[model samples]
Target: MRGDVLVVHETEKPPESWAAAVLLTEHPDPSADAPPWQEEAIRLLRDRWAGPGRLVVFAGGRRGFPSAAPEHAEGWASDWRGTALAHSDVVICRSPGGGCPAGVAGWGAGHDSGRIVLRVPARPAAGERPEPGGPEVADAVTAALAHLGTGAERTGVQRQVPLPIWRTDSFQRWYGAQRAAGNTLLAARPVWSLRIGADRRLVFYWALHAVVHVTAEDRVKDNEVVISRPDIATAVLYVPGATIDDTEIVLVREFRTAASTPDGFVHELPGGSSMRTTDPRSLVACEVREETGLHLDPGRFRAHGSRQLTAPMSAHHAHLFSAEITPEELEVIRGLADVPQGVAAESERTWPEIATFRRIRTERLVDWATLGLIVQALTDRGHPLP
Candidate 1:
C-alpha cells in the first residue's frame, strides 16, 4: 500500500465546525511513495466528512526528511516530510489546543499499495492485463482505510471474515508446493476482488489481493449471484450408534447468526476456514476435536468434492471430507462431553454450551447430501458404508 498522511486539528467555536478539519498531503517525487488512489479516497471522504472544509496539501518540495516548519509549533512531527526520503508518515497531537487536544486523530497507511489495489504482483498472469477493477476495488481500499481507524465514528473493521477467491489448479499446486517448502507468500491474505453484477452493478470484496473477471453478458436481469466465500471445508465425523458395536460420526448443531436455521441450530459439519493458518486436514481435525472432543489423525480425513454446499445463502465452493470413527475415539467423546472447560474468561471467549447428540446413528442427524458424501468417502477408501 502507498503511504498516506492525515493531519487533524482541534479548533474552537467557529472553527469548532472545523474541528473535523482534515489535511491531505501529496509528494511530488513519484518513487517517494506508492501510487495512491486519491480520487477514490477523495470521493469516499467527501461523503464521510461532508463539511465546510477540505484541503489537499501538495508538497512541491519532495519526499524525505523533515525541515523545521517555523510557522507551526516547535514539536509538530508529520509522517511524510516535505522531501523525497521519508514515506508514509503521520503527525498527531504535537501542539496544544484551546481546551481539547491539539490533534483529534490521524491516519497513515504504509508503503504497501494503499491497503487495496487493482492486482497483486504475486499471482502473475504474465503479460495479461487484469480486468479493470471497478468500485469494488475502491470499496476495498476505503474499507482498509476504515479498518485503520480513519473514520469519525471509529467503526470496527472485521478481520475474521474470510476473503473469497477461485483458484486454478496450477495456482493451487504452486501454493501447496510453497507451503510444503515452507515458503510463505506475502501476496496472500485480506483478499481483494472486483464483483460486477447485473446492469453493470458492481460491489467490491476485500478478502484477499485477488481478482475475478466478468463479461457484460455474464450479468443477470435483476438477480446478481455473488458468492462471498466460495472455497471452504465442511466435514462429518462418523461414530458408533447406541451400543458402540460399530463407529459413527458427529454432525454439529450450530446456531449461526449469519445462517438461518429453522430452530437457529442447523445440522452442519464441523469445519474451519481453509486458510494458511491451518492445513485443510488439520483444520478438520481441530474442528472435530473442538466440537466433539474427538482426536483423529489429520491423515484420516478424506477429501471428496470441491463444491460442497454448507448453506444456500453462501453459494461458495467448499470441500467435503469424512473420517472413520474408532472405538477409542468414541470413549474420548464420552469423556469430553461433560468435561469442565475450566474458565471461558481467558480470551474473553463466550463460555461454550455443550450439547450431546451421542447414542444416535450418524445417519440419524446427517442430511442426505452429507450422509451420501460420507458413504462415498468410506467406499472410496475401501470401507463401504454399512
Candidate 2:
C-alpha cells in the first residue's frame, strides 16, 4: 500500500525551524483494529524510513508523547480521540515507556524537530504486524514532505468597493458630467462564460480612493441606496431527500418589483445579505435556516465557485455552495418561527408569502432564472448540483 504524507511547519514558528511531520498510516490485516483502507497509508510511511531511527506507533488510546529520552525509540497514543489518523507538529502521541512504539517496525529520520505526533483510531484491539513498504512509497513520501515544507507568502490586502446602481435619467446625466470632468468610471470586463440573458450585462467598478456621492435624482423617493463594500461571501445549498439517484434541491420564490419579467416573481437559492465579514459556507447555512426554515448539515455542504453580478447600476459577487439534506432535517426547519432572510430592502415593501417547495427536474433547471444560473455554474465546475 502507498499513501501520501505531509510535513508542515507552524506558521507562527521561525522559517528555519521545523515544527512537526504528519504521517497518515494504515494497517493491512482485515481483522486489524484500523480499517483496511488505512493500510496503504502505513505502508507509505514505513517505506520512507528504511533505516533505523525513532518512529512512534499509536494504536488505541495510549499516550505517546514526552519521550523519556530525546532520541529514544518509543510510541504513544494521541491526546485527541478521533477516527482520522493525522497529526499536527505541536501535539503527538507518545508511549508510556517513553520510546517509539514497538508496533512501528521500520523507522527513519524526519525533518528535525523537538515534538512529534502520531494519530491512531480508537479500536478494540491492537494488531501486532511488521508492515514494510517499497522504495516507491518512500520516494513519494519524501516528495510530499518537500512540497509541504514551502510556506505561503503573505500578500498585501486588496480592498473591494460595492458600487450600487439605481434606475434614473438624472444619474446617467451626472455620470456623463463626471466623465467630462476627467473622472473615469471603471467597468469590469464581462466574464463571457457567465452571461445568461441576451441583454447586454454591465458592471460598475469603483476604486477605494474614489469618492462616491449620491445626488437626489440618483435616489428613489423613500428608497435608500444600500451599497455593501465588495467582499468574499459563502453560500450553502441544502437539498432534502438527496441521493445518488433521487435528488431534490431546495429553493425560494420571492416577489421582486425590480424584476422586468411579467410575473415579477424571482426564484432564488436560499441565501442572505451577508456583511462581507462572514465566511461563504457559514453564511449559506445560516441563510438557509433563516429564509426557508431548514437546518442543514454544515459538513455536507461543499463550496463550488464564485461569480460577479454586474448590472449597470449595482454589482455583487455571489459565492456558491452545494449540500445534502435529509427529510428529517426539513421537518425540523418547517417547525422554526423564522426562515433566513435571503434578500435585503432599503424601503418598506409587501413581503411575499412563502411558496411551498416545488421539485423541478434537474435537467429542466434552466427554466428557472437566478438559481438556475447558479446551479448551471456549479454543474460546470463538476460540483454535484441537484
Candidate 3:
C-alpha cells in the first residue's frame, strides 16, 4: 500500500503504507493516557519515512475539541501527545470561541508531508454525533489531506478545505441568501467552525480561508478565522424626552468573558445574533424582550441601517435599529433593573440597566461600536446628538 490511504483504529497493525496513515480514536479526552500504539506510531514517523508520507491522528470529544481553545498554542492537542511527540509543531485549527469537539493540524517534521494529529468534531452538523466509521471521519481525513497540500497523497483529494456545511440547514440558508444577492463565491474553504444552540447544533462561529469574487476586478481573499454569525440585529432603545439629558437609555449589563472590565461585564444596548429569524426587526424584538424583559412591538423598531462591526477580521455586521418607548414603558423597564435575565440554556445572564442618555455618554459607559450605533440612530431620526 505504497500510495494508498490507510485508516486504522486502536492497536491495529500498519498496512505497510508510506503515503498516508490515518489513526482514528474513539477516545474523547485529550488528557487521557495515550494507548501503546500512539507512541509507536510517532516513533516510526520520526525515524523512518525518507520521502512523501503523512501520519494523521484523529480523536473526538463531546464537550469540545482539543484544538478549539482561544490560543492555538494552548490547545489540548499541543501537550496531549506523549513524550515521543511532545515537542512537535502543533497547528490548532481556528475555531473562534471554541467548539464542542474542534480539530487541529500539526506537523511532526520540517516537510509538509510529515506526521500530523487532528481532533475531529464529535458533532459535525445539526443533530449529528460522531459514530465509528462515520462519514465525518472521512471528511476529517479529507480535510487533513487537503490542508497538507499536494504531497500528503496521490489519491486526487482536492487542495482546498472541504465546505462541511452540507448537513447544516441554517448555513445553507445563509449561503443561499448571500449567493442570491449576487455576492458570487470564487473559492471558499472552511478553516474551523463551532455549532451553537442546545436543542440543535448549527454553525454559529466559523473561520474560513477563502477567495470571493465581488466585482469584475474585485477578488477578495480572506483568511480570517472570524467568519460566522455575520448578521446581528441591535437597537438603541430609549424613552424620548424634552432634551437628550433627560432621555432614558436602556442597556443590559452582562458578563463577557473577553471583556476588559473589572467585573467582566459589559453594558450595551439590547441585541443578539440573527438566529432562527431572518427579519432584523423580529430578531431585535426577541432580543430586547429576552435581555431586558421589555416586550416592545416589532413595528416600534426603526431601522437605522447596518454597518460592519469588524470589517478587517470578520464579515459580521451590526443591523442598527432605534425604538422609542413611552414613559410608562420606561417605568416598567426600570422595575426590572438588576434582574437576572437572558436565555438560560445559553448561559446568558443579563441585568437590565436604565440610565440617562447624558450619563451614558458622559461616563463613557459603552464601547465605540455602541456609541456609533447611538449616533447613527439619533442622526437617522433627525435628532442628532449635540
Candidate closest to the true structure, highest lDDT = 3
Per residue, candidate 1 scores C-alpha lDDT tens digits across 1-386 of: 22223322211011111112222332222223322333344445544533233222222223332222324322223423321111111111111111112132221211221221112121226796533334543554344333333322111111111212222222344335434755444222332344333421122332333222223344222222223442556675665344222435555555455445455544556664533445567777766666665667889888876653544343445577877667676566656544532113422111122222332233355455555555565566565344
Residue 229 CA error for candidate 3 (Å)?
Answer: 1.3
The C-alpha lDDT values of all candidates are 0.37, 0.36, 0.54
Q: Write the per-residue lDDT of candidate 2 for residues 1-386, one digit (tens) a residue.
A: 22222221111111121222343433222122332323444445444633232232222211222212222111112212221121222122222232344354321221111112232332323575433333433444554334233212111110011111111122334445545755543321111111112321211222122243335345322222322223333443444333322334455555666655446755556665442455777777776765666666666667766664443333355666766556566546544424334434533222212222233443332134354444554465455643
Clashes of each: 36, 34, 3
- lDDT comparing candidate 2 with the true structure: 0.36
Looking at candidate 2, the ten consecutive residues that score lowest on lDDT are 154-163
List the lowest-lDDT window of 10 residues for candidate 3: 105-114
Q: Which 10 consecutive residues of model 1 have the lowest summed lDDT? A: 10-19
Question: C-alpha displacement of 152 in model 2, angstroms?
Answer: 28
In the range 1-386, model 3's lDDT, one tens digit per residue, is: 22222222222222222333333333234424433333333334333333355443332222221222232222233333321122222222212222313233222221121224454344445676524334433444455454444243322112122223322333454446556766655444454565555522345666555455555556664543325453789988887767776678889999887788756789999999755647888999999999989898999999878777766665667889999888888888889985798998788988999888788888888887887788788767767476
For model 2 the TM-score comes to: 0.33
Candidate 3 regions with alpha-carbon error over 4 angstroms: 1-189, 197-200, 211-226
| lDDT (C-alpha) at residue 320 in model 3 | 93
